[model samples]
Target: MKGLRKTITTAAIGVLAVNSLVMGGFVSGAEIVPGSLQVKEFRYLDKELDRISLEKTGEPDGTRDGHLSLLIDAGEGTEIKSIVLKTADRGGTDTGHGIWTTWKEPSDIGKYLLAVEHDGKTLNKTFKETLGSFKGVNQFDLYASDNNSMKDGEYYYLEITTSAGVIKSDVTPFADADTSYAPVLIREFSWTDLTQDKIGSAAFGEDGSTDGHFKLKLAFAQKTKVLSVILRPTDEDGKAVSAGIWRTNRAGVGWLLGLVQGNKIINTEFNKDVTAPVGNFRGSVTLDLYATNNGSIKNGQHYVIEVETQFGTVISQPVEFGNKESIHTDSTVFPFKTISLKLNAKEAAVDEKQVKLDVAPFSFEGRTMVPLRFVSEAFGAKVDWDKKASKVTIAKDGSKIELVINRKQAVVNGAAVQLDAPAITRNNVTLVPVRFVSESLQMKVFFDEGEIFITDAKEQ
Candidate 1:
């Protein structure tokens, strides 16, 4: 019974109700009325196995012992004459067909006449009573030895031929009993120079120069195929830029290109129909981001890469492309600086300059908590405090961080992010988690022997 329950639950998850009418059929002298029959729920019951795998493997070795549980809803005032369940291969050839009658004789009103056929052989059976006999809801538990036993890669669907019209359910594939599901994982992602030499090649055309190239590495936990790879620009706070501001190209209305692996280009036309099975893939993708128009990628913008696979879609962390020096006319680069603080110490160092803190840093709940105003000011950011609301806001460059006292949620530029620990107020000084605040402001935090170091430089 436990195995039967698990099979019912697993099959219920893959049920999709998409009912449509069969077109191009007209009666000679009668006006056609649309049928109101719908397949409410469909479940594949395998008495031998406890679970069914939705992954598409090759055809099964042989047929399995299985049945089907179908729940149908016939609309009011519309009577269903007969119900047909059929199985077909991937190429639309009928493998099995079954027909059940609802209205026949006085004794057949409650008893259903079921007949199934497979390979020119017919099996007839009489079902006692249908479940849920009230209010047009009917449940059918169908069983057939050879006609119902389906192989992997075969599709099954239900069609209700009512007095009005014919209503067909969406075709669903039979599950493979051998394959288990596993999601794809993004192993590594970064900007690289793998495709730098081939910038102006015939593959890229003449207008496809980019400031940098993105290297994406993926690992397939199971057998899967790549669908698409997209690169989208984001803000400093990692929110995607609006679609109106997306960078376009002369190649197409949107930025679309083939991926490069070593020296070869795969998926040349962005066609997903002709993809092979992937194990571990590493490739480089370049986007043309320079134009004199308004929708081009900005100078100091950040971008993220999204890879869609057969298992699922995975997104990478945001990485910056250009800096402030490229955006502004002034070519002056901001000097990278490091700030060091010690636990329970009133003194700190900012690039050899000593500063005094009113409240010393301490450990709260295994997290390093530091004075909010002192640390934010040291990093050349402006801090504003609201006494009545007990809220603190830190702003630097284009990033804005808002934190409320005693709250575990913080907002970065308009997006809400969870904090490792809530901000606390001690002796009228606000203390926050150093790592969360530093990372939110686009800085890196490191811990040594007894001290904490914060830096604005790229990690080596």
Candidate 2:
């Protein structure tokens, strides 16, 4: 038997029990990986080389003198350490009952051959051979691991030559093989160290934008690929809202993922963002995420971040939006953290040189509604009014936001945004919610003492 035990030892039997747990603790070894075991095709010639079976093996006629061979393939990630050939052993000295290796022809019926063809060359290998019985099941250990194990994507098979007895030795193949007896699979994954770093959002002009945008950083030791992102924004009372969460595309032409709903995302396509998580990293990804000031994304609400990777879904701690939300950090984070994005900046102190609006903004239903021209012009934004169309357009820094008179909706860069309040005319001034200029123009605005302080790249 070439040092191969005729029966499974206690340790080998132990695996059988543990594998049973995955498939209800009642299936076979094949259940270890669930149908990962199967026989492909086999062929054999009778004693006189007159009869052949180039298909699935059926019951032999117990005739003597023959040669047979089988071809086997394992599923991915499957490690075939050993295999058991099962056959019924009819009682009462079955006359033709016996088997041997086909080493030198029509005499041997037990010796198996293993080979791997690569680059037009074939390499022959050895296998531990054994005949065994387990749990009242007649099983032949046709092949077992020595230094040579049945790895996935390798060629392995058994060849049998009968001495009149080979016909009696019933050989069971994978097609009819029981999975409950199959071996376990070893799954492999591309290891990566991915983590979320500082998470902060500013509702003020702190980052040069008052419309309310948040910044988050993700760190990894190597270049990583982002599969998907899920955002869940809730108000003070914890109600779901749609927060427009997006990231700049590689082409820089536009943004990807225009919107996210109650943390649900329908866009599944993703790009590979190569990041260095181990060095003195200063480049951080800044997403302009904010509450649209609508009922769903009102300021002072809490939210969470959920992302999917190859391993599984990764979740972030609950974070509040608006104002400056505290971020989470790790000791492993790079010491030199800097603002790499030109769109983000630290808020400047209340300077004497301030771009104050001519008409002080007033509160409408708890919202600080300001005149579109004063707010836009104060921040270097060109304001255009179409008296014929009754539309007000505010263009600044590659962005164009338009609002219709007495309308509660505005179009930002061709994307429509619904508002909680409408633009109204007061004393010949087209007063609209501060959000139009803040969120739409991404210009941070702070209301203090009835004066609207406008800040942007110039001020920052």
Candidate 3:
């Protein structure tokens, strides 16, 4: 049984209950570092290899043998140090009923318990050596009745530790033996000239109209191979206008999805029924088509999704395939922090040479990038700068900020700001006010004590 057991000793469990009662406990653990738990080791039980790949879909089959071994990283900062494996007693003689080896004990000699001490906490799971009562174990029942409810080949949970709390993901696995889907590439057909030359021949009454064209690129990860593709287009009402499956050329040129490879006109179901996501490009709209790749894609490969319309071809900005591991990272790097208010600078003043402001959380180059102005104004400071003289000033309730340009030197409320390009003015706008905006807003400005320090603080 692949399951979970909160490895806290009986005493530790009491402490958590007490803490919750006293603190009005609202705990979370998944927000620690990303990808904290890794699959350290896994093995297929050779004796029961057939059962490991059994298809329990549709109808239940008790003839399958289910047993496996997995070792995970279990140590400090890790939420679970062990897993409990519980199996039912099949042979009325009580031979098959026992615990699988856990982290606390080795499985080499038929010991039970998948995870154990040597870490901050432990979790336990069970595996069925042979199909028996059909009642398997799961994370919820790992400690109760010494069992869990789970089918063979199911993934249980991911545990992580955080300052505020711990988190877990209830994951499950599937077998490919039951059903398999062949991957297909989706591409829109249309024509385009990279040179931007005007085609004299017109297909419509509008300008830039040409004969049938196709967008060669398909929407899938770069690592995904185009085994086969189905091309379909629908009107605004989702009535299919054309549909065909094309085989891609080894070297991607135009698509070969119509009839024969550069030979015949492919048969199409123009009247087929379908639905598509709609997007507007100026006055015209296009249908958003989806295509499933024929194979599993690498987690982070960038791919291009292109569409061809009667007007012209519009390509989607490149996107990366989703990865289970990066979900938390993406949220953290793009979470909503503060709203940014872009304001035109008012004026320049004495000792008030720089200003700071807060910005809504934004991302650049996979990092959280904030606006300087929003960060500053949030601190109750009036920011102003001189584009010609390259001077910036911040006055909050008479607190002054004086800063120079292209140098790690400035005075904020009499304190110095060691920043490069102090309150830079660009396009008639100032960027990055004096670092003192951090202290002014009661924020913590952190860095290597080098050229510049990024700061964070709550708005007033």
lDDT of each: 0.47, 0.32, 0.28
State the weakest 10-residue window (summed lDDT) of model 2: 1-10
Q: Return whichever of 1 and 2 wins on TM-score.
A: 1
TM-score to native of every candidate shown:
0.30, 0.24, 0.20
The top-ranked prediction according to lDDT is 1
The digit string of per-residue lDDT tens for model 3 on 312-338 reads 122222333343231101111211121
What's model 3's TM-score?
0.20
The prediction achieving the highest TM-score against the true structure is 1
* Runs in model 3 lying further than 4 Å from the true structure: 1-371, 433-436, 444-460
Lowest lDDT 10-mer window, candidate 3? 132-141
Residue 165 Cα positional deviation in candidate 3, in Å, after optimal superposition: 36
Error of 2 at 132 (Å): 75
